[model samples]
Target: MKAVEYRLPKEFDKSFIVFTERGTYFPCPWHYHPEYEFVLVNRSTGRRMVGDHIGYFDEGDLVFMGPALPHVWVNDAAYVQGQAKEEASAVVVHFVEDFLGKNFLSLPELEPLKKVLDLSKRGLVITGKTKKEINRRINGMIGESGLRRLSSLFTIFDILTHSSEYQPLASPSYMQHTQGYYSDRFSKITDYILRNFQHEISLNEVASEANMATTTFCNFFKEHYRMTFVEYLNTIRIGHVCKLLADSDENVVNIAYECGFNNLANFNRQFKRLKGMSPSEYRKTLELQSA
Candidate 1:
């Protein structure tokens, strides 16, 4: 289900927020970007669901997200309960895909960059030593507006284009959803799964909650979501595990059991099925990344 949030772009201008975030460091919920987004997490320790890409992100991480890809940054529950206020600082620049189109990079010049953006459709997260330098450049131009902001957008992209440490977080075939398309019923399903993903969920049980029969509910869900109930549920569960693996010191076996999978073997199989890497390996990658 889609536990999405909506914030319409009020202006039809050629640009938008060329910064990371605003107001307090609150949750953005699961959503998509209509514009190409470049974000650098200066200080963060939560798991992020970016497009189809799911993983744990910490300090010094840069993610390049393509237009309309669904993603969310779920703060560890403890943080939300006023546990840790230090978890803040992220830089995000949102611009139309063709903001400088037909001008800056010709199709031939864009070949390599296009590949980078294509890889980003599923979502790409970069954590490396270059983090400090990029942060430096971004900080140098924090309040930059007008023409300078546009220039900074290109500069941020330039840094990403030349960086070698980034990795694709989601699969290539992942498509994004618009805010208008996500409904309240979808939110209920999402909330239920997040709270109850640790147990077996039957179609009848969920359908009853949605106030529909088993078969009708199945079609209703798939028609709007494009993924079967189980597919969506597993994605949510997998996304959670990716977070637990990175930030928590919990053992893999315990994490699997906690996220609602029946057995360690099944968890490993499914984790690999959705993430293309085993839990331990994914954790190790984060360790090396955050080191």
Candidate 2:
């Protein structure tokens, strides 16, 4: 109950059109709401963890997650290493299930879209044509009124229902655990890791930062992230390393050291384990890649 951060639209009592200019830290600490969420990560690169899904996300990444589904966007970057952080802004809309109507979902007129929303109960990645329409409609919603706003949202689902371009990201029946004292503790812990992934961050230091016993911290951290504190630390670090691997001309050994990996051999091994490739191999693949 304490997990979901429900910051509804400014005039949510009358309408569900939610819009905000996200700061460098967009949605942090894997929070969800009781409302359906539509987010377009305009042009940006950041860490994305929703439900049990964990990966790096880039510009034009559009995602939808149902109520109380934990998700996060960890981007403290001014730039992707030497390159600039993405220039585009993030657009978001949040609405309750009942905002439209109960039968709106039950109607055969809405079945395909109904199934998509059902899939979105886990999470959804809307791409291709649907992404274009959602982006266009979200932009069009900036100055709309009561009925117009609802109709715009209806149009969004219209695209989702008809488009096979949409993909489900989180597994069916997925549930995210983000409750209690551990939530507060890891909010602090993960926030710190994002802020300091460029350097060495030890479990002891992180536990001290959270003011928790190491063993207790490890257990709690694992429960939330499904990995020990060190593992989560490496996750954040490895992401930065990938940013470097793809965006930088830096040497693999140097990038490893820069990302806080103490030993080169270990860096290569861990990068492979987490990224499915050696550092050099990852870098080579990114050579002149568009995204």
Off by over 4 Å in 1: 3-14, 22-24, 85-87, 101-107, 176-291
TM-score, model 1 to reference: 0.56
- Residue-wise C-alpha lDDT for candidate 1, range 1-291, written one tens digit per residue: 243545546345545655556323545766765677777777656677675455777777677777777677655555656566675768776666666654645667555676567656766776676566667666656677678866765676677678877776753223422221235786566556656777898888899888889999999989976789888777767767776675588998888888788877877888898887888877765554333
What are the models' TM-scores?
0.56, 0.55
Q: What is the lDDT of candidate 2?
A: 0.67
The global C-alpha lDDT for each of the candidates, from Candidate 1 onward, is 0.67, 0.67
